[model samples]
Target: MSDLNARVVIIGAGHAGGTLAALLRQYGHTGPITMVGDEPIAPYQRPPLSKAWLKGEADADSLALKPLEFYAGANIDFRPSVKAVKLERSARRVHLSDGSELGYDFLVIATGARAIALPIPGADLQGVLSLRTAADAEALKAQVGPGKKLAVVGGGYIGLEVAASGRALGAEVVVLEREARLLARVACETLSTFFRDVHEQHGVTFELGASVTGFEGANGHITGVSLADGRIVPCDAAVVGVGVIPNDELAVDSGLETARGVVVDLEARTADPHVFAIGDVAHRPMPIYGRMFRMESVPNALEQAKQAACAITGRPAPAGEVPWQWSDQYDLKLQIAGYAFDVDEIVVRGDPKSGKFAVFHLKGDQLQSVEAINAPPEFMMGRQLIGNRKALDKAKLADPTVSMKEVTA
Candidate 1:
């Protein structure tokens, strides 16, 4: 186990895989590290695809996790545009699409997830797109311009972010959501309302309670979206941001356990001790939440990568931290820390109309989570309180005159 010359193979050169490779080297692992990915490019940041990149504020090179030379200098063999066709667990080898096999002493599955394609008709039209990769963002960007009609399906973070970006590019955006509210899955009603209003103020239209049945098009390009109510929202292009499916087929084929994602223990180890799963493709144990959950965020990927590296190098796992997520929409910055499901009470501080506020979710007096909008101080303090599971008085926490330190103390 102490041998540093062991071969470590990582599937999917994504945030998790790429980060793990760098961390392994940092932790004094002198082994041969190879990262295989289906994409032709190196690991890149995905968050900016719908925000900065689509708005033309950032370029492809800026999205990369590390410079190209970093991988070579660190002796990390990064194989791009190569699909992992099969995983031979018995031989501890991975069969790739290019008719090659890679042997490994340790394997990490960071294949990540893909955008869920709509099963509806006309989804294959030219102008219909989903944002998941660098290429996807580039394609979607071409469709955003002044006077362009862009219809966004679904009301999730991806959909909303793209809508905001489209609006910023002077495109006419209409968001179609089956639910009556925006961000219904993740945010509370108050936070959702705030975002909905903010987007509306930015001239982004929302068609709540609208279900898309199919897309309408001519000459192989999307022209409009047909709703279940027999109405069509005309658009020149459409972006589907419904959700994503974890790329766990290789794990399943290799006889590894799979649920919503590949199931992994606290140390990111899979059913096979030599194999580990991280990032969006891992349903890892969340001890604080008393359950296994998959977090699709940069912080989650980096933290899990560190854990996997430590485990591989015979080091103890890092201390647990509360899960956090953030989103950028025009001028608004939304930051959320911890899970807020099934909270007994919700408290609010600051003024949403003033473009700054924090919504605190509490199970009785215990601080469960915080959704802060342009409120950096609240986010910082709230994250600490959630990590410590500190209970605070609702009155004091909601009072702007009372400082966060006083409330936490």
Candidate 2:
């Protein structure tokens, strides 16, 4: 079949799927493209849903990836509120929930992920929620207001952001993290301490090493949370930000390689030549890290979408950049570049107490990662250093007086 006449079907209309659809057209592919999503709304930004949008600083229209007319104008078949139930790999067809089958020459699975819910009893009670979608954010926003007591059950970026937002809305906020420190899984201890102090100064309480056995509720609504040690934390609402599980059931059911996410090559191709995956759903090999890196960030989604589009169009994948992520809490902006795992030393620049600093994670003078707190120069330079595989002098990097360019040079 000619490339122009080929049919491409994409499942999931989040950042990855939506961006791929647009890029396939932009890359001069005249094929018929269709995108299916379970949500009624079009593809929208998820990052702001937890921060600005939840705080009433941004509106729904601002969250859209593209204007509604863009899809129709581009001749892309966009199906909203539709779910792809099963994948018929052999026949190259997708069975939809609406009793329909869509035939495709190429299929892209970008199912993203779902928030992990607490398995304990009373988790299903009213006032307990997890944020993942637009509906979820709206529900959370309504529950957070003046005088409301909210307990955030996790100390990850999402949980801390929710805590900051709750404080901004005049809600009494308490963050309950089971780990010894905030962001223990993803961040260095230095950065974690900085964020904990910031949250505490904003009137948000933190309970480290606290485990919730279950929730205490009345009549269907949760009134409080019961800790493992028999202590009950009284709250009107709770937001569970434990983590996320990749939505890769379709891939697994179709007999595709699966781990925490769908296994894909560096080019985002699945085990089957015709099948591809991207975004939070694909576990692709990272040459820099020498392992499969499953990144759950917007930058990763955008990069993978472009690579998948190029691969589908018979183009070579571009050189990959260092993975990066960002978060907004209160007036502070945190930008992270590179992975900090297995670092031997951590160097801090500037002052955490002054609310401006950067943490450099190093393995024998080689830059492993950077956590920049309201420091754009550090983030930009740090990303370049990691991408170029450049090592720096620890003393120069830790000195605030030395410019980022000088340190990197």
Candidate 3:
């Protein structure tokens, strides 16, 4: 089949899947494109679901990835409220939940991740929620507002962002974390301290190193959380943001190689050349880090979408971008570039007290990664340095007076 005329089938109508279909069309793919999503609505932005949408600052129309009319106008067949139940790899066919089948010239599995549910008791209570979809956000939004109390389990980005939003809506917010510090798994100690202080100043309570034993409820509604420390945190509602598990059952059932996610290469091609995986469902090569990781971020999704589109449309593979992610809590914007693996030193630029600083992670003077808070220059320059594998003088980098360019020199 000609590259542009090949039929494409994409599963999972999240950010990555939706973006891939759009990118394929932009790359001059005139083939038949069909997308199957379990959600009744089309693909929409998920990041905002925990923040603006939860706080009533963003509406459904504003969060949509693209208008419903765009799909029809682009001649893309978007099947919402349908599930891809089975993947017939040998025959390049997919069995759907609606008693239908689809044959594809190329199969793109973009199935994203799902929120990990709390295993404790009372988890099935009426007011306990986890934010992963628009429906989840709406449910959470309705319960968190003035005169309400919200108990958050976990201190990761999602948990912290939700706490911030809950606080903004005048809801009493208490974050319960088993770790001694917030963002223990993903950020440096200094950055963690800064965020913890910020949240605390905003009147959000923190229960660090607190183990949750179970939840207490009455009449099918959660009322409080039982902690190992012999304390009961009272709340009207609760949100659990422990982490996410990739939706890779179809790949596993179809005999595709799998690990933490469906294993794919830089081009997003699985063991089967005709099959490709992208977004949160893909555990692909990270050349810069010299490893494989299932990156759950918008940038990773967009990059992998381009990678898959280029390969399918006969275009040259695009240059690899440094893996980056961002989070917003209150007025702060945290932008991170690259991974801080095996770091030997960390340098802080600017003042955390002034609400502006960048944390630089270095391995023997080489730029490994950067965590910048409200500091765009540091983020941009540090990202470029990381991509180039540049080394720097620690003193110059730490000096607030030194320009980012001069620090490199």
Candidate whose lDDT is highest: 3
Cα lDDT tens digits for candidate 1, 1-409: 4357789999998899989999999999998999998999988888998999998888768888999889999999999999999999999999999999999999999999999998999999999999999899999999889989999999999999999999989999999999999989988999889989989999999999999999999999999999999999999999998889999999998889999899999889998988999999999987766788888999999999999999988877899988999999988899999998668999999988988999999987778899999999999999899888776888999998899988963
Cα displacement (angstroms), candidate 1, residue 59, comes to 1.5
Give the C-alpha miss distance for residue 189 in model 2, angstroms: 1.6
lDDT of residue 393 for candidate 3: 87
Residue pairs clashing, model 1? none
Q: What TM-score does structure 2 among the candidates reach?
A: 0.98
Taking all chains together, each candidate's TM-score versus the true structure is 0.98, 0.98, 0.98
lDDT of 2 by residue, 273-378 (tens): 8899999999988777678878899999999999888887776687898999999998899999989866888999999989899999888767889999999999
Ten residues in a row with the worst lDDT in model 3?
1-10
* Model 2 residue pairs with clashes: none
- The list of candidate 1 runs beyond 4 A from truth reads none
* lDDT tens digits, residue span 1-409, model 3: 1379999999989999999999999999999999999999988999999899998889768988899888989999999999999999999999999999999999999999999987888999999999999999999999998999999999999999999999999999999999999999999899889999999999999999999988999999999999998889999999999899999999999999999899999899999998999999999998887889999999999999999999999999999999999999999999999999889899999999999999999988788899999999999999999998876989999998999997874
Residue 146 Cα positional deviation in candidate 3, in Å, after optimal superposition? 1.2
